[model samples]
Target: MPPTSVAAPPGAVTAAERSLAPDLARGVMLLVIAVVHAHILHTLAHGGAAPSGVADTVTTVVVLAFGEGRGYPMFAALFGYGLASVYARRTARGDTWPATRSLIRRRGRWLFVFGILHTLLLFFGDILAVYGLIALLFAGMLVRSDRRLLVWGAVWAVAGTGVYALVNNLLVADVEGATQVLAHPLTDIATRAMTWPAMAPLLLITSVFPFLVGVWAARRDVLTAPERNRALLARTAAVGIPVGVVGGLPYALVSAGVWAAGPGTATATGWVFMLTGYAGGFGYAALIALVAARMGARRGPVATALAACGERSMTSYLLQSVAWIVLFAPYMLDLAVRVNGTAAVAMGVGVWAATVVLADVLRRAGIRGPAESALRRLTYGPRHSARGAAAGQPAARR
Candidate 1:
């Protein structure tokens, strides 16, 4: 006979109940995120320029091939996974879809507000607002059938590619000139604010497809059932990563000056590279899931620390931007010109290391990250929490 299962109260997942794969993936990817954002921010701060030498060329190629388009998609996928997981939990707790959707929408609203503030205050490259906006824009669609989800994902990908190609073609000449304003402390903020409107659509175009795929994965409980899906994960990792790299090679070449970048070149080739991010993103995540499956449920300092960082990813993500503003913004340290790509990457690593340590300390103290706690409080009011606890509701099985 199969063993009987018990559910925990809504939103009360214990440490043991959480899957290690998702958390580990998030934690590791944050470093990738840091480095990628730092690179772009640095380039924008100084104005874009082609890499000059073999060493710089190699570095730029490596980053473009493996890091550039990959990080954000992976992060967005994880976001979808998390959102679906939460929705599953709420439904399993006997909460009506209306109630659950209401709470999630509330959370999404806060996320948008947070994103706006983060962008205005620190970095124009902020993605939180994009994610927030995505949630609000697509809330109703999330509950669509898996087949429909796949269709929508495909539609988004195709449409996004066309849109990016058009936009890139138009913006090719302006890219370098626009970024030059960042060189001035007084003009940087105004430049960023002005440019943000244009960035919003591109953000959606780049992120929506992967976000939907993540939602699909969550529906299948892919990460949660990694062991059972090892073959699938292996296949995906093997095929996706290589194909993604191949697709991104042109961008790497352009960045390295091996292939010259011009209006025609960027317009024709840029979208090809950008669109490949989806594959790389999914591949990276699958590879991580495969690794986590092998890791089992082992507990140690490294694992704990990584998991903690993942759990508090929102704070860590924002903190990375904060570090960038402090170190690179002209109004602050104004080190953009001083720091080369390699040096900026090193700085990003240092910042990521700091966040990992902070996360560990908070974990040990049994304290939720400030942003996470606030988000939780905002999403689920005190009254609902009390009701769930008093009812002794079982947790979601997945």
Candidate 2:
């Protein structure tokens, strides 16, 4: 449970429960994703050669090491955490449950639309539509008992990842026959948009398990009271971080040609990737939640800022697309080659910091961030309008 002083009094949002760590982490991760894509777009535009420099080398190594498989996991897990939160809040209100299925379906639709536009106009590498689909699919698990939710969620996720990993392992393992084997579908927009076959497994590996794990954590009040779960978290990271480092690192490097191997070896290494992801992914989520619980942004500028951003996460996500388009659009300044690997990473880090500052400033002004305000209106507007209309009806005389 949350600290006694910080816990809500049987209702409503609480000041103490707001922590911006996840938002900042999420922003940072998205920024990294942007930078990486910028580099890849440059590569695609210029036949796989980024500008050579010390900065490029460091960026390449760091991106290869830390940027490959981690960010998506974190984002997906956070999404799950959000799901758990919404479900809990709805169930607690004793009000009619929202049409969650319809809600998620609409969200998925928006994601698909947004993702298609993003892929075509800007970057071909996109995950939004698929992530949205997976979220809708996973919504059914919200009401399950904790154990069954965790276990079955894990089963579905692992099975999905295993099948896709098999495909990736077989297709990606070969260097000599790579061109002849198969391209990453469109190697561009078409693949990322509505390629349901490819996306099904990708979603399972990339987002689903972490999401369920997040739901599990929320169930236990793990974030609200992390000190109570420190030992579990420490043990988790101890096991997970190393596995992620030792096992997952190789596959990424192999893909980069550091230790390219056969299909069998690639298949073996892919297991390591998934294992470390589950282990380390769980560890990271728990650790962050615990960190938030203990050293919360309870009553200060930081807390205020993060809470605003968290409330507006969907908005912020969309805003990121806008920000990137403005920054990278060829017609804007034709900066396709100007931003290199290292600079892109730096920009990512910087953008995240800017977002935090922006969040805080928006909070102080009593103005919602553009994204937050939009989502708020979108989410609650219709229901509120309906309620208002009903409340004005004349009472019946008995």
Candidate 3:
């Protein structure tokens, strides 16, 4: 039976209680995300033209190999990790599964709301809603056995891969048109509102496997205590990164016009690219964890900066969305049409760098991200929310 008491769980995890690796991974993941979105917007704006020069081709290959499909899965995994951490913290405090589940779903519900507003106001490629929906549906899985988690993860992975492959084959040509920016702001908003609903579910399918894997890893404290899992992290990095890069090469080549491929070959390679991207994403996380393990309590400026951005990842992410709208939207600066692929990539890096600095400033100011604060408040209610705010502890999941 569920615990009858409806008491709130403890306040958010204080700064000292937070680990460095996951935060670092999230910080780095945002850079990749920025690059991918910038490139996609560039391509869509240009009507999916092939790379125009050496720099553009190089950017295409690298992003396709290590960034595009790779970043989100890593984020998803981290999301799952954060979710599991919350569950563990609450359960350890004698909170019942039922009560914890409610807390999680509440967070998820708010995230969905945030996602909706984000799409309407900024970017249509928002992922918060996708994660939110997953949490709502799968909160019960938190209490399930490890075997069940793995089995379900594998199931979703297979299904997601097949769906991606099929979608690629059928809709590859239509995708550019679907995401094209309309001239009017109202039209763009309406289009995004229409498109997001369809895209969210598709994203959910591809994202679930990584999220579940993250949950499993968190249960074992894989990131928090990376030194203890050194061998495992090393093995994952050794294999996963290479697999991801190599698997991505064929599609990258085709996309860059370096290699010619018929529709059938392109479709096949696209499937391989996406399938290996999961490995790449997991590999990236493991690699980051290994790096964090080596850093070992040394909070250097660079690491501190990245971790700061990571800690406020949601805010940083939304900031990027705003940048994108200002820079790329037709009604705004419309730089997408003005810039080449290489320039777009550079802009992405620049934007990420700016956010890093901004995040560091926020860290120095000791002000939690407004988005994070709002989410904590909505998830935990005003009473506990006030306490968390006073303590400046961020919510478990970024």
What TM-score do all the candidates reach, one by one? 0.90, 0.74, 0.94
Q: lDDT per residue, candidate 1, 162-233, as tens digits?
A: 687778557645676445336564476676677678887788777888888888899888888899889989
In lDDT terms, how accurate is model 2? 0.55
RMSD each, Å: 4.0, 7.6, 4.1
* True-vs-predicted CA distance for residue 176, candidate 2, Å: 12
Pairs with steric clashes in candidate 3? none
Winner of 2 and 3 under lDDT: 3
Any runs in candidate 1 off by more than 4 Å, and if so which? 1-16, 178-187, 382-398
* Top-lDDT structure, candidate number: 3
Model 2, TM vs. native: 0.74
Candidate 2: the clashing residue pairs are none
List the candidate 2 regions with Cα displacement exceeding 4 Å: 1-28, 31-55, 95-123, 166-201, 263-271, 297-311, 329-339, 382-398
* lDDT score, candidate 1, position 181: 36
Better of 2 and 3 by TM-score: 3
- Model number with the top TM-score: 3
Q: Candidate 3's residue-wise lDDT over 73-143, tens digit each?
A: 99999999989999999888888888888889999999999999999989888999999999999888788
Query: Quick one: ranking by lDDT, best first?
Result: 3, 1, 2
lDDT of each: 0.77, 0.55, 0.86
- The segments of candidate 3 whose C-alpha lies over 4 angstroms from its true place after superposition are 1-11, 175-179, 393-398
